[model samples]
Target chain A: MSQIKPKSIRQVRAQWDGLFWTTMSVFGVFYLALIIAMLVADFRFTNWSDMTSLLSDARVRFSIWLSLISCTIAAILSLWVAIPTGFLLARLGSESMTQRLGQRSPGCRRLFNWARYFIDTLLDIPIVLPPLVVGISLLVLFQTPVGRWFDQRTGDLFASLGYAGIRGITYEIPAVILAQFTVAAAFAIRTMRNTFEQIDDRPERVAITLGASHYQAFSLVALPQAWRGIVAAFTLAWARSLGEFGPILIFAGTARMKTEVLSTTVYLNFQFGNLRGAVSASLILVTLAIIVLVLTRLITLGGSSNKGVIV
Target chain B: MISVQQLLLRQGDFELSQISFEIPSNAYAILMGATGSGKTTLLESICGLRAIAGGKILMDGDEITRTPPAQRQIGYVPQDSSLFPTMKVHRQIAFGMEVRGFSQTERNQRVEELASSLEITAILDRYPRRLSGGERQRVALARALSFRPRLLCLDEPLSALDGDTRNNLTKLLKKIQQSESVTVLHITHNLEEGIQLGTDHFRLEKGQVRAVVGKDQGGKNTA
Candidate 1:
């Protein structure tokens, strides 16, 4: 390792510091300018009459509502599966558990390592695989014998609840929700896993010695401290779901008033040579996505003040 | 009374072999060792927090070597106090009781009693982040003492405090031991603490642990 002399207090601002900031900021602005320039182009492309006409359509209203409702639902459902999965992943190799299990045979430890690898691979699928592939995968699953059996029972249950008109996920509206969940849940898990990792395990161990079972300690001591993280994960997942076009389009198909969310609405309009309607719909989604991203940043800022579960 | 016989623990590159000690009922036993000599590891083993490859740990004439921490009836206070930052002092102290199924009235009364004894009655409503180091230690102590465990395992309980705070807490530890008549296994690197408080002295040297006397018990050369 090369040892560099420490700079004097008077020379705190070095030549390298100025060059570093200038180079990084230029690169940052280059990426940021792309989004700003594209939005500006959208504004220039569509006229006031075209924008007004697009918004007046019943299909546009339904698409916006569908996107908002489905994304929010997917976000909430993702947390239910994500929290425990994230917690387990975050706490897997903590000192207490590892040391306690140190006496186990070599085969057991190796198996434990493999189990962790398997879980991580499973979690990475929706994120690493293309959105269209996720859609195709779900579509392919429904054609299998076991998948068909489960869908038949589920379809009957939905029919009993008067959602027969909605169609029982023969690649229908519910497929939009399934597709969003597949992708959004991976984001939720990543967010929550990082959140849980930030909390110290000492307090949880202390709670255990104080007569709390593992579940009680986690729920009472650990979970309460992760409140901000839960909100962040949900919102980020919802925001990610809002931009899901390829998956929902392939899995659910872009039928207006049925499976037409904002992203798909833009695609459908563009396919039909309705460029004004496409641009208008795209701008609305872009605006909504920017708002969701800003909200995520604000929530993160609010959470930064909390000191976690340890003093 | 608590007893450890031929305890063997291995963690990564470090190993403790054939370590043994006994602390009679209500006795204050101090275990002294250098930084990496396995004093804390042994304490954790007694508390069932660490896996022991070969050993027998008996508390009050019953073998509890493999028992889980929650069922071991051992109160532990780590080096930094490890108080839950999200909780108020009152709730932190009452948590053990809550877990042990104590009623609200019982929990409140016990918290009041421990807080008064530990001289932290004024800061009961404050969070751990708001409390000073001494105050946090007091809350950790109150919490550990909440369920009235038969054995108390303290890992350098006063190591983090300043000189004045250390003296005050040392006095409080003595006072609590006298009042509660609880068996204690305290690990410390301080000689003054061992001499001032211990009725029995054990020291770990080159991964082997045995009892020692007076002036040389906590010395660096003992390792």
Candidate 2:
């Protein structure tokens, strides 16, 4: 009787384990199925002819070129600021501010802590805000008196640099880049900050002790180690910039080919009831995103597996 | 000679106060302390990695308390050997020289010399991740000494190695210290290892430093 009871318990335990795994698999596969369904729907809504027609359209071609150029520029600019900002944040945020400040008065230490907290929160504002809210805020900001004055000064500066006819940044091509950068740079900075945090700072300290200056240590030791992170950040920013639509719409406007981008082209086609054209443009973006993902993986894998050469 | 006087350091609630010590030039000095006793902190302060609240650090009668780490001419190897992961062994060894604007020929010559002396010539082109624990320590040692800093600070460099490797490295350390004629301030928790390599010994306990007098010296404090 006892032996029979034990066997029955074993059977029940196995059944429970099976049920648990089945539940987990159902949850996991649900998301995968949804993504696959989306791709299938996109493919079904458009044909090769629609894709060809979209490519042949000059407006679509202009949108494609502008998307590429603006996204690339925004990504470059994001990296330019993100690298240093990320490094500083990683260093400062990782170490105790009290220790770095050293034996200061309580008031001073409190002030420093508040400042650090404020800056960190400020940096995260764009990330947490809704995309449409970001667009609205930027639109409202440019209409302010101070913003208008600054825009005029920058316009004059650009004119002096031989870029005539750029009266202001609002509703212009530069606004597209600016709007994309406003949000895309935030993501790049966050990615890079995480990257730098993951890396040990001991090598840079060792480099300094070995008579390498701060800049030398950063460039030689830290930067080389961070190459994969840099690539990831750039690709992420580029991808985010490519898909940015809300801010560009509100800030730069549609304007046909002047400030139009791939994302806006998709939106415009959909608004005009050109479902096939919209799906085709979305497919183009999906294809580009896949290419970037593959390239990033290849570059990172190449760096990791390369045995003889330094990255 | 390296000297510290009344060094006061505070991190959060932990503090090390009124610490004073000195090691003669070319001596292998070992610092012994329990975990969290601030041995690493003191080493970092001397290396200019940590800010000292109130203290004077002098090397060869010149005060370098305010000097930047690059100008301090100290070579530091942390507990994990903290090698640059992206650089080949040769490049790691040559990094300091390259950054300091040494000619390519000079950098090459120094790297070769350090690699040969450290018995790491076979692994010059390999990245640090491929190295075993002992090899990593040896490479880190080579890199630190490549630029010929006046002082070498090693924080538990052999702690992570196996017993056999640890014994081998202790002998190698002694041999290299003598051959290179560089002053060393090594931190270790192992008493026997400290005695084996150290010409001068100091112990940190409860935030204060005291010279560890050997039996041969009749228990007289030297610093």
Candidate 3:
């Protein structure tokens, strides 16, 4: 004898079959309304010339290029500096310092702890300090004698390579990159150090035992294992630098077709009542940001998957 | 032969003093202890990863107490089975050879030999994360052995494996030891494993060597 299927009241609802569809539809409607409103507003006052000129304008092109190049430079420098800092913080704990401190007095440990706290507070200053303040501080420091001396010593050739006859860190690409790096690297170091800390020390120890030296162990073992986290840190720093505004404005003044990065160009366009130019530049900025985000996601995902392939 | 003498170190709240031991040429020496009994510290001191506050380690009559870990020529397989996650199994096995300046041909040959012996030939293209616990241990062991060190030290080699896997790995380790004729200093808390593989066993307690026994029932109080 064949068995007959039993019917239950509201079987679809009871089984959660329709719940997903309903949930999706609710979110879909909200998203659709937002998109429709944006489209209507965009179409009502949209000027084709503004969009076209924004892309075709030499100044706008230069601004986009400048932003990309500076942000890339800042991000690379930050990673190069941050990785070592993070490694030292994670692997070399305060135990050695604590031992030395113990020789002096118990209070020294407390002092060292306070020092760590102070550094942490210093790191937090970037997040809270307005970008304009950061830029002004940089400008003030760059104008100092010591700063000029150091710059002349290190950047004589770089100055010669530039179109303008300028010496030391002021209103230049390097200055902008340096300011962004100063803020970005500290945050990157904090992020990467936390990640490196979470990884077990056993791997590096194992590598050393397997005949790899300190550098070999770090490069081949620790760095590779922590690749995903490092990539994430680099992405964060890069994105932060790309979006940087006030610091770039004050340190690297807005010179059209030269130092006019995306943010500054947009600001200048708005100030001059060139609404179309402003909107076009804003769109370009948004498009660049979206492309970067998508690229980062893809790269990170690929890197993580590559790590997973190792076993 | 590997010999340690008068080892001493201080790390806040714990002190290691006068710890000494010897493993004769090509013999398997098992170091037995509870956690925090300074077993790992002693191993690390020999490998030169940890600085000895006072003491000396001699391998084949050459002093290596002040040597860096990379130059020590001691193959170390840690408890966590540290396989390079970015590498394929083959590359992981060959990394030590590359570091030690071995020729590419020799590295490849050594990897092939180790992989086949460990029955991991099929997993050569796989990564460390994709391997099972036992497979990981096998690859880690293979990598360590590829270096052809004077001595191989394992810190709780089988501690991470399931019972069956541990038993199987013990057999594999014994086979590798016999074939390679390599000296070994293994640390473990497992009594059965100790009895099965150890030619001579030393018990450690509270930073001191308690006793040395030739052979006996597993886990008898040495002190």
DockQ of each: 0.70, 0.72, 0.49
Q: Is candidate 1 or candidate 2 better by lDDT?
A: 2
C-alpha lDDT of all candidate models, in order: 0.86, 0.87, 0.79
Q: Model 1 off-target regions past 4 Å?
A: A1-13, A47-49, A105-107, A302-311, B219-223
User: Model 3, which residues run further than 4 Å from truth?
Assistant: A1-49, A94-125, A150-168, A302-311, B218-223
The candidate maximizing TM-score is 1
Who is ahead in TM-score, 2 or 3?
A: 2
Give per-residue CA lDDT, model 3, range A1-311, as digits (tens).
96655655457556686787788899989999997786556444557777887778888888888888888889889889778888877765534334434334347567767877776677668777899999998888877998778667546876567734545567866777887887888778886777677666677777777777788888888887787667777877887787788888898788787578888888999999987677767666766766776766666665433431211
Ranking by TM-score: 1, 2, 3
Residues B99-122, model 2: lDDT tens digits: 778999999998888888888899
- Deviation of model 1 at A22, angstroms: 1.3
Tell me how many residue pairs clash in candidate 2. Answer: 0
Ten-residue stretch with the least lDDT total in model 2 chain A = A302-311
Model 1 / residue A170 / CA error / Å: 2.6
Q: Is the docking of candidate 1 incorrect, acceptable, medium or high quality?
A: medium
TM-scores of the candidates are 0.93, 0.91, 0.82
User: Residue B159 CA error for candidate 3 (Å)?
Assistant: 2.1
Give the clash count for model 1. 0
